[model samples]
Target: MAEVSNKQVIFKDYISGFPTDADMYITTSTISLKVPEGSKAVLVKNLYLSCDPYMRPRMTYTTDSYVDSFKPGSVIEGYGVAKVLDSGHPNFSKGDLVWGFTSWEEYSLITSTEMLIKIPTTDVPLSYYTGILGMPGLTAYAGFYEICTPKKGEYVYVSAASGAVGQLVGQFAKLLGCYVVGSAGSKEKVDLLKNKFGFDEAFNYKEETDLVACLKRYFPEGIDIYFDNVGGKMLDAVLLNMRVHGRIAACGMISQYNLDKLEGVCNLINIIIKQVRMQGFVITSYYHLYPKYLEMVLPHIKEGKIVYVEDTVEGLESAPQALIGLFSGRNVGKQVVVVARE
Candidate 1:
């Protein structure tokens, strides 16, 4: 087989603060389409790439973190949807559609088939795998239903509620007959939380100088469940506003990811005062429940009971900017990059 040009997004170095488009560079390299003889690797044509906040932590130089840091001068890796062109694995074959951890490139030779999931249904858009039916979906499902243990008529609050996981968490709360409110960074997202995602109340956090007072106004009875995405001050405020026996599912701390010095939450004593339970989770811990998750969420998606919003950029060249846009709140929904069609 002839060598084909592969366009890739390469990590420049370990970042100290907020990442920029300059932190990653696009370069072209040649690769043979065929897998090596006797290898259990699969060659994939990447379709869509997901830009997630979790990827930010991996950019830093760290050996103690749960996930491995991205190597400098190497192709950046993230979750993506792809089509199998050739496979040496028994579980996958040519023309198979899958979603998994793939490099930010047009094509990739994926050796870690364990991480790859075969796409069973094609009725929905393939890009949905990068957001709704993918990691974000499972994260929201496990974090809310499993961790929060939601009940009907509970008062629920979700931070970063217009983003991928948060949006779903709000909707799920509503589905369970809970009174749900959400917080976002902008007016447009605030509107989305109320009008589109079906939150009972929504607020723009940037507009509120006093977060504690803001939470008081929204949840006068105090929050029974808090789906924490943006931690720090928001968390501190929620700690004060939480009802006795409240549950907090710590999904992501987006507010602290880019900070040079991580902010401390002083109101942690409130957890003990109220006898509240606060738990942090990693999505990979619940991968065994993916089948059950799909069984529940997929039907809701097909029946129009749940909806997903995505902010998509076209081509491999747009990958870096799309990723950097996450920290700045430039994208209103799930950030995705379309690498190829088919």
Candidate 2:
């Protein structure tokens, strides 16, 4: 190992409204990558980190959010899959592959060993842990199964359907015998959702003049479940077309992430009239159900029933652009960054 340390991405300051790549930047540091002797921490070489929409909230200094914001001047922390190179903790040994919250850098000294879960299977690509097999997958599973509670033959709609979580949610809905439709930002994403991810129907939201009318046309009987990814206008439109007793799983709101003033939905009364139940969630709260999710999803992946899409960036240097692309619908699939290799 080199005596000098490596470069890491740091938050420049507390952001307001929307976040841009300029809000964060990469910097060099000389702090030792390894944990000090006798310290109950493991030193890890980060391989891949996931870029998600939720990370946007963490960039702001907000105490009301589900999680605390990332401190300015410090390395931004997010979900990363890494390989342990050294450890003073008994639970982990050198060479162990794991995934958890790690600083966006080549190496990170992870103090919370409990948060890091051992990679039990190497049969699949290790990078899967940064996406399909990690937090995104779990979020899709929990949101669909636990929140949406779809029944056979029901109608399901997924917004931003070609994304990391949206793709999985669509496939999972199909497996449960539901009529699933999805909306994406472009023709390419629409085709991926329909032809690749096996969604029943998909359309480019950009091409559609009125979202509510689009939903009404596709879902003639109205949507039984709505897996919302892009909030604001899309969500407002969805509420107008939802069937009686419809369930909405509020997975993300990428559409409103960058706006200075949030959009207001004009159809708030629809929720009460239709008995629509909308709920927002954080995946970390459902970590206890991970094994259950894996048991259900792993078989589908192995049997080739489940399909995942990802747009990967090469190094930590490209992470800022990759993450910023989420708000603009620039990323075609799950955005991930390769930080290092074992």
Candidate 3:
């Protein structure tokens, strides 16, 4: 392996309110792109890093959360696709591409070989691993199939519909013969949902003043399943329009990410009245189903039954803005940062 100065993104401090790029700083250090001899670790050159909403929680050092925050002054870590430059592990050989948690840097030494899954199919773009074929994909799969459990011809609604995970959930529901409607922050995103994703209907939530009324207009029969990505008001609105025995899969809450205080959910009684089942799950908890998720989504992707959209920012230097863009709805699709080329 070659010696190089690794350029990496560092967490400066615990974040508050909406985070700015100033909170993160890029720094460099001298390093060799190889794992030391006799160590069962793999050193990799990172290709793409995924920018996700949950990562905001990780920016703040919180002990109450299921996942720990990124340590201040350390390299920030996230899901990324990388090419192993050198390996001392039996599971991975040199030059193999894999995806897992990795630092936002040019290269990384990964000891958790178990978390890194070798990319079996390279016919698709390698960056797909950052979103559609990685954590976000698994989140969509698990949230839709396992949590919502939709029946054919059921009415389905997804908030933040044009997002990486939300878009997939909408399409999956449509594939299951369900009537799907999605709400996006912008008209462009709403158009993408209807035209590109083949959703039954889509609306710009920003334009809708009465969310409950808007939902009722679209779902006259009531919603059978809700794929919730933006919680708070959206979740409150959906609760009023949910059908009896409906299911809610809480995938994320991008709307609540920047708030100084988490918003309170207003309608708990609706859950009991409608016998609604609302479950919150972390992708890590359902990792055992990843192979099953792969089996289901990979074919759809290969056959063009499913389509993926990504907003790629060139260079690791743009990583800070790309991640912060998620909360502002500035990103049109799955936000990813290109750290280095293969």
Candidate 4:
């Protein structure tokens, strides 16, 4: 078989503070399209790549982290959807669509199929696997239902509400009959939260002079469940406004991820005062519930009861800019890099 040119986005070095497009560079390398015999690996043609905030942590070199940091001068890896070109694995075959951890390249040879999930429904856009039907969707489902344990009619708040994970959380809250509010960085995102995602209320945090006062205005009755996405001042404010026995699902701390010095929250007293249950979670821990999540969400999607938005940029060349844009809140919804049509 003839070798194919593989274009990839490679991490240049360990990043500090916010990452720039310079932190990653695109390069081309040649690879054989076929998986070697007895390799037990699947070769896939990447279709869509997900730009997630969690990837920022992988850019930094850390001694203690749940996930390993990306190697310098290696392809940056993240969640993506692909079509199997060749496979030595029993579960995957040619033309099968799958989503999981894959490199930032036109093609990837995925050896570890343990986490890879074959796409069962192609009725929805295949790109949805990178967000709603994949990692972000699972994160929202596990964090909200398993951790938050929300009650109907309860007040819920989601930070970074227009983001991949936050948008889904707000929609799920609405579906569960909870009164939901979301906070985003810009007016456009705030508008999306209310008009598009069905949040009860949405606000631009950048416009608020005092976050504490802002939370009070939105939740006069106090927040019964808080899906904390952007930590820092927003978390401190939410602490002061949580109702008795409120639950907090600590998801991503996007605001603090790129900072050289992590921001500290001074509201532990509120946790004790309200007897709140606060928990931090990584989505991989809840993979066992993925089947249940699909069963519940797939129908809602097919019925038009749930909606998803995506910000797509064409080609692997746009991956760096798309990844960097997350820090500035440039994306309106889930940021996706379309690598190939098939």
Question: What local distance difference test score does each model get?
Answer: 0.94, 0.89, 0.92, 0.94
Q: Write the per-residue lDDT of candidate 1 for residues 1-342, one digit (tens) a residue.
A: 899999999999999899998899999998888778899999999999999999999999889877899999999999999999999999999999999899999889999889899998999989999988999999999999999999999999999999989999999999999999999999999999999999999999999999999999999999999999989999999999999999999999999999989999999999999999999999989989999989998899999989989999999999999999999899999999999988
lDDT of 4 by residue, 1-342 (tens): 899999999999998999998999999998889998789999999999999999999999986988899999999989999999999999999999999998899989999888799999999999999999999999999999999998999999999988889999999999989999999988889889999899999999999999999999999999999999988889999999999999999998899998899999999899999999999999999999999999999999999988999999999999999999999999999999999979
TM-score of each: 0.99, 0.96, 0.98, 0.99
Instruction: Residues 139-186, candidate 2: write the lDDT tens digits.
Output: 999999999989999999999899889999999999999999999989
Candidate 1: minimum summed lDDT over ten consecutive residues — where?
30-39
Clashing pairs in 3: none
10 residues in a row with least lDDT, candidate 2: 1-10
What is the alpha-carbon lDDT of model 1 when measured against the actual structure? 0.94
Model 2, runs deviating above 4 Å: none
For candidate 1, report its TM-score: 0.99
User: Pairs clashing in candidate 1?
Assistant: none
In order, what is each prediction's RMSD in angstroms?
A: 0.7, 1.5, 1.1, 0.7
lDDT for 104 in candidate 2 is 91
C-alpha-based local distance difference test score of model 4: 0.94
Worst 10 residues of 4 by lDDT: 185-194
